[model samples]
Target chain A: MNWALTLWRLASFAVAAGLIALWQLIANLKLVSPVFLPGPDRAWAALMRGFSNGTLLDKTIGTLEHMFYGWLVASVVGIALGAMIGSSRAMRSYVAPSLEFLRPLPVSAIIPVAIALFGLTQGMALFVIAFGAIWPMLLATVHGFGAVEPRLYEVARSLHMSRLAVIFKIALPSASPDIISGMRLSLTVSLILAVVCEILAGLDGLGHWVLLSARAFRSADLFAGVILLGVIGYVTALAMSMIEQRLLRWRTSGH
Target chain B: MTSIALRKDIPSAELEKSQIAFSHVTLDLGGKTIIENVSLDVKPGEFLCIIGASGCGKTTALRLAAGLYQPTSGHVSFDGEPMRAPRRDVAIVFQDYGKALLPWRTAAGNVALALETIGMPKAQRPARIDELLKKVGLPNHAAKYPAEMSGGMQQRLQIARCLAQEPKALLMDEPFGALDAMTRQGLQDEVLSLLDASKATVIFVTHDLEEAIYLGDRVVGLLPHPGRIGIDLPINLPRPRDQLTTRENPEFLRLRRELFDFIKASEA
Candidate 1:
């Protein structure tokens, strides 16, 4: 690897270290009770302990399963809806009001309704998160697809390209960047929704773990869970965006 | 597939009868008329270039000829039959250097996409693709994607792809407009050579008046804003045009000046 890139990575680590040091110094100086404000070391130790027994791994996998499923379902449905909205003026005009109304309401805001319907189950959390995450994807898809060159569409028609060929080869790749961007933004929202549902409903996921630890004065475990969730969210976003970049190689077709 | 052994000697009269005709065509875009009562007649193998300013409806008229768009008034017909949609026998080369090309496909594969679109036999496509690539002077670039190639290379590939369809008539929308001077000169020669070799009638649209004069048997100029035929001039320039000789010729200068005067008047 180039030294510049290596240095950038090191710098990022250094920033994280500085933040941890500051937090630890503040807690130690009695800025907050040790019972409530755990040092980074204590959180790290709790993280290692949780991983050593696979309890953290199990809960992480559980949360991840819900997240991926919700993401997949929402992405598929959202893309379809968005394409339709983009292509047809009538659908866009008709569907605009309802989608606008539904999108602004927080995923957590729908938790009571989800619990009432699915009784605090994984389905309930997944539904809330997926529904929440879908708007960004739909909006992005509509905009991205709408923005594809009209000349390109006419070319497709003149070439007698089949509907499937046009969608897969033309529409999807063209719209992918915006779609992935929306999805990247959605992943964070999904995590927030998942955590909110887990904590408020006392469901068996990361947020539930954080709540349990914090309630029992296990501040280290609570911080550890929070940090793990952050890492998961960040890593997933990075990977998806990388895929977006690769597929959009054509967009950079210039010297 | 070339079956040289079994080819019968078809008469020129019979071939000339199968011509492309645009009959008093007027095109409308969003309630704004572009082509106003424009008529064109092309004999088989004729290279006709439509020259005009930007937004002069050169492209609109070409689209009508290609049957991509229907005339809001009058009609574009092929051998007396009104064009319903894109004809199976015609191919178009867009100016955006095949930005319309499916990105997933290789240069050969982009050509092959038309084959696939028409549901041609899978076995015949590769050989045809190779022949076309060779014809377009891009045999080695066949495996490359449009994104990988230079603008000129991409245009060559697109032309090669159009050739693979074995079109009876070619409609090109200023295919070299995006290229630099040297590359544009090279591709123009390639296009001329291809036209010389094939019997395909061509209706090329270009904003470049010199280009219109250089390649066309007849150059039709359209004026912008309710685009109508401003001038239609026939060129008697000899085949295998010598770049230096043709550009320096007094006759060529006279034709260009006349075209410029017409265009200037149109702009005014």
Candidate 2:
């Protein structure tokens, strides 16, 4: 099984590598302007230069900090509100329509309002990121809590569980899988919003760095910055998956 | 009388206590009647099974006994006190064991939930949990999650969790309905022996007439469309009943035939 999985992974990676190789070949053959698309070597050189100067790392760290703070706040508030709303039909009915209206508005559209309110500060970026991240987490948590088996509640009642105990011990754990999946989505959204906010607000982040490179006609540097963002996104998703696996070890493949 | 005396390990003073009773109980749900003017008396150490068709509301009656539901207008009491809510002294085993046991908890953890409810100290729970698991024939499955176990194993684990309560009354709602025939019979005997040893009052609800006769001290059949009692038959088969002998006994056969006819008529 391990061998088969390894072979499958290798095959999947080969396809991705083939795409990258084709992009590099196209750049080298000058099918696209070097200003529009640099070769892999030029991109690699640009990445190495940024690493040597330490500017890239600083911008990456700044962007990550904004994303993380916003994501954290969103997660805490989303779970609390979701649990409250999910556990009671009246609360859901009262709040659900407004939430639905606000949810469909894209995160980028909120940037102008945030900037008008908070200016080009970190606070503006944070607000945009948080506003974007909250929806998926909140929706997922609501769904998870709602889908809990009725029989489990009956069991909790039969055990004479206090309402608090029932919520904390039974409801929360049962809803965790959906909550984690939501968090994964929100985390990715938070990253996207952080970059967008940084670019729009002119904050010193990876997004700003990419904008600076593009203005100076440094296509290779711009590509390097985009690659770095991709790497960060991939790593964050991977970390979330590992945490989910560790926490939900009891969940079988059959489930 | 002889079997009752033999099963009574308690002091004579506590032997004949009335554990649970339902008096003129009428249950209405969503403005529609589910149970109407039904009465029952569950004596100490008795195994009473309620059997009926799909709409009979036998499970509703069991829920009332477990204090999960309240009668529209009547008394459902435990030890002479009106049952307002579920108490630690009464434990319920739901038919959907898959939903009843926490998927995240191991078998031992599920059993420990009862001990935790009783506020048993952490230090003493392991020994008690081991004993309960052993009683349910799940000594090797303490660390297994409910999803990892077979249907029969999960049901056994559910019973173990109930036993952890040291309950005076056990309410089961078609607990073995999902299992195969052999597994159902095996669990039926296991439950009998455990109840015999603990002397807990049991109210088992099932639609299977043979199961009603095999495990119950008295089998009560409920009629549908308001869910009232249609027949109450005392099962006089001897104690320590075997799958072969007791099922073949004339009394068991008579009750089975009577219940079969009653259920067929009710269904029609």
Candidate 3:
């Protein structure tokens, strides 16, 4: 379509390719061991091997499934709890201290406890990821619900809306933009947690794939796994942006 | 005492007054009184606009009348019953239209919201929504979300939505204040025309003196902190009044000037 944008994209790709070429040259000259700097071609072959053998793909799906479940659990629970706490002064005061205390405790810090309690099971992994992801989302949902225009609530009242009708029709939609923003933030955190859990907890995921390759000195596979995780992370984040665009299209154009 | 007297005088007036009311309406936000010793006698099929400076609690007065807030001292009765929460016979069009609508729904979906709120049958809502869309000149924009709309169009949809409740009265809080000049006047005319067609009792709140004068069958000026009636000015202009002539007319100009001087005097 637009030549300027097309050319810029092409140039950026070329620059990326050039950087890879330089890495290949350094590895070939023995400037660095292949253990640390496997060339792109070698990495490509390893990626093919993993894909052909189905190990990489399987781990990828496992990682995604964890991300999916973790994000879902966290988002749903966070939104509901956040709304409850945010709307009620009593609930907010009761829960605010605990949430503030726990939100800062790193996901890594909790893994040992999770492992000891749940013993490296899916439950442990899901809990760790969900725990971290839910915090930001819960706060967002609370704020979103709190920020709902009072006038709209009056609209519900004047229309003689049932309590459920007001919540579903007015309250949820009113607070959705802020809540979605929270979910977007939480999703990245969830993905990061999934990978960290896979690596430290010996779980079935891409993080484990990377760790295994590195220990065995399978340099190419290790590099491929890291690169694959990067792509997945980038795509996942972009997908969230697209979803927000579609969902809040009303807010965008309204007078 | 007066309420009982009025009710007995007119057999249908309670049903008429059940449309909306405010009496000795004292409102306390936290512990501070916002509206006090306020009273109004509104009939069905009439338009009343409240005008005042910011923080005057003119809006609060409407809220009290709508049963959005409980008066600290006086009682607000709707249709001869003590007002509680919001009623289905009255609908509000907010100053901030964006805040009123759901971001996920289309214009018609937003309009259909009120009907759904009142538990209208689902099977019949679509046709009602379509009728509203056509009435508001948004027949083709039913599926268009609020975000896709221009300010005037969004307000139009809001008006249509308020009407969908088939309310006996409409409550608006500076609904056109945020629009550009051209759009504001256009919406004002459109709103007036719609009110004329429906004969729906309307309680519109605005800070604009011109808008208050132009739209109201009577303009009630209010003062702040403890909101009280500053002036109760009536417009006796003939029906289906024109904007240009009415604005330039001697009676309209005199009332506008008197109200303008009244606010200035109050501030002084």
Best-fitting candidate, scored by DockQ = 2
- When sorted by lDDT, best at the front, the candidate numbers are 2, 3, 1
Question: What is candidate 2's lDDT per residue for B1-268, written digit by digit as tens?
Answer: 1122234355666546678889999999999999999988888878899999898899999989988898889989999899999888898998999989999999999998888877899999999999999999999989888989999999999999998888888999999999999999888888887888898988999988899898888999999999999999988888777888888999888888899999999889
TM-score of chain B of 3: 0.91
Report how far off residue B120 is in candidate 2 (Å): 2.7
Residue A69 local lDDT, model 1: 80
The TM-score leader among the candidates is 2
Report the TM-score of candidate 2, chain A only: 0.94
Q: Write down the lDDT of every candidate, Cα atoms only.
A: 0.82, 0.89, 0.82
Per-residue CA lDDT of model 1 for B220-267, tens digit only, reads 889889999888898877555766777777878999999999988888
Compared with the true structure, what per-residue lDDT tens digits does model 3 show for residues B1-268? 0111111122464434444567677778888888889888777766888998788897788777777778888788766778787778777888888777765788878887877876789999999999988877799999998888888888899889989888877888889988998888777777777776676778999989988887787899998777889999887765455667768889888888988998887676
| Best first by TM-score, ranked | 2, 1, 3
Task: Report the interface RMSD that candidate 3 achieves against the true structure, in angstroms.
Answer: 2.6
Using Cα atoms, each model's DockQ against the true complex is 0.31, 0.57, 0.54
lDDT of 1 by residue, A99-215 (tens): 889888876678888889999788887788789889889999999888876766766777778777877667777788788889888887778777887887777788889889988
Interface RMSD (Å), each candidate?
2.6, 2.0, 2.6
Q: lDDT score, residue B71, model 3?
A: 85
Worst ten in a row by lDDT for model 1 chain B: B1-10
